[model samples]
Target: MKKAVFLDRDGVINEVLSSRVKFVNKPSQFYLLEGVGEAISLLNLAHIPTFIVTNQGGVGLGFMKESALHNVHKKMIAELAKYGAHIEDIAYCPHKPTAGCVCRKPEAQMLIDLASAHNIDLSGSIMVGDREPDIEAGKKAGCKTVLIGDESDNFAQANIVFPHLLAAVPWILEELH
Candidate 1:
């Protein structure tokens, strides 16, 4: 079975504009964090497929159209490609948080679906994100979890914690060996 790395989109792959709002509603608002492209390139070099699993509740809440979200993703993908990095696939939950959708973070439906579709070994895979729900989803899918962001008691459930995605990649690669 192949091993993969699952990543959360917003805070994990891009800079989160918390000062403006929690969600990125437009392509202009989407910006890749420093070193993200390089980290992904390293993962690609290591032959580990990367997948993005995110909850875009902004669509369900009417904050943005699905087309706008697609545009944003296109921009992100293109930018990563410039760095010789590529994401295998992106799975997103476009429902409201209250919609009770199984595909959202903390539910593991998306990860499970991806695992089935790609023949991935969940036990050897890792999920990296900046939120509690991300860790929960990874755990539910039987993946080791890496939490990114400030250290806090809230992230105690994560198998590993780091300040950013770039820092987590080396640890993940080491763990895989």
Candidate 2:
């Protein structure tokens, strides 16, 4: 079994827009948050497989086309590549929150599927996210959870918490060793 890191996309990887326009609808709307490149690059250098598990309900709501999301990912990938970072795979839930899809956060389906596909050891993996649902999913999947933002409500649930992804990197690397 292999260990891995799972990251939530929105607030963890890039800036989350205001409530009115919450999704990155186009490539231009996507921007890697500060330290994201260096953080991911370090993970790459360590040979840790990293993946993105996100909820993109905007697709189901028709806020943006799937193609647009692809473009946004392309932009993100290019940006990360500039720092020698790479992502192993990406899994997302396109269903609306009201749809209650199994792939959505708070459900372990996406993590389970990825773990199965990648032969990962869930107990040895880490799931990093900015919200409570992300922590819930990690718990369901039996992985250690790291919260990237100050969500007081989630502090008890997360195995660890940090102000940002870059700040969490050292601890994450320590855990792997």
lDDT of 2: 0.90
> lDDT for each of the candidates?
0.91, 0.90
Worst 10-residue stretch by lDDT in candidate 1? 15-24
TM-score of each: 0.95, 0.95
Per-residue lDDT over 1-177 for candidate 1, one digit per residue giving the tens place of the 0 to 100 score: 998999999988997866654568988888888889999999999999899999999999999999999999999999899899999999999999899989998999999999999999998999998899999999999999999887683454899888988898899899776
Off-target runs (Cα >4 Å) in candidate 1 are 19-22
Cand. 1 Cα-lDDT: 0.91
